[model samples]
Target: MKARFPDRAKLRAQVWNAMDNNPGTRMPAFGKYQALSEAEIDAIVDYLYTL
Candidate 1:
């Protein structure tokens, strides 16, 4: 997690920021860039669960 395990709220915000706030933005730090990154998501989820 690198000491940055963002919570559900943060995750939602990232997704929203990419979809709404940015609208036309690409390479977003959220899901779009990481949308297909199930490995990353799973890793983060696992780390967050420990906290």
Candidate 2:
């Protein structure tokens, strides 16, 4: 399963971009997360690995 996302940096960027820009019609934009720092985003990515 972990092989699905081998690049942490790319995954982080995807997460950031998704939040920065609306991904699609159904997924709401998480623009509010723009206030979060890079470290915070990294933490979020790290936490995601646990799931």
Candidate 3:
């Protein structure tokens, strides 16, 4: 199996703290984040299952 990332809350925190170009989302916009596509979100379901 592939390596799993962090959990939902954890992932959200990570993404929130990460780089997000969108103003409506993310706290800090200057790390490693962007508008995640539907497929990408699907792939990260485990990480965002709670939301």
Candidate 4:
């Protein structure tokens, strides 16, 4: 719920894959979460699910 529109499960997966640098995943490898720690990514992903 950090943004005006909350991220859906699909969107969350996109972000997750990008962070994991998995080009074969659902979304493209945007690498947005590359700079974040694994713990931070987990926390954010968990929050997104709650939204």
Candidate with top TM-score is 2
TM-score of each: 0.35, 0.58, 0.26, 0.40
Task: Give the alpha-carbon lDDT of every model.
Answer: 0.53, 0.62, 0.46, 0.57
List model 1 lDDT by residue over 1-51, tens digit each. 325534555554544344555666674554455554656665665555577
Which is superior by TM-score, 2 or 3? Answer: 2
Measured on C-alpha atoms, candidate 2 has an lDDT of: 0.62
State model 1's lDDT: 0.53
Q: What is the C-alpha RMSD of each candidate to the true structure, in Å?
A: 5.6, 3.6, 8.7, 6.9
Q: Give lDDT: candidate 3, residue 30.
A: 24
Segments in model 4 whose C-alpha atoms lie over 4 Å from true places: 1-13, 16-33
Worst 10 residues of 3 by lDDT: 1-10
Which residue window of length 10 is worst by lDDT in model 2? 23-32
* Pairs of residues at least 3 apart in sequence or in different chains that clash in candidate 3: 19-30, 19-31
By summed lDDT, which 10 consecutive residues of candidate 1 come out lowest? Answer: 1-10
- Candidate 4, 1-51: lDDT as tens digits: 546336455555555465444656665443364656556666777777676
RMSD of 2: 3.6
**What is the alpha-carbon lDDT for the whole of candidate 3?**
0.46
Question: Number of clashes in every candidate structure?
Answer: 1, 0, 2, 0
In model 1, pairs of residues that clash are 31-35
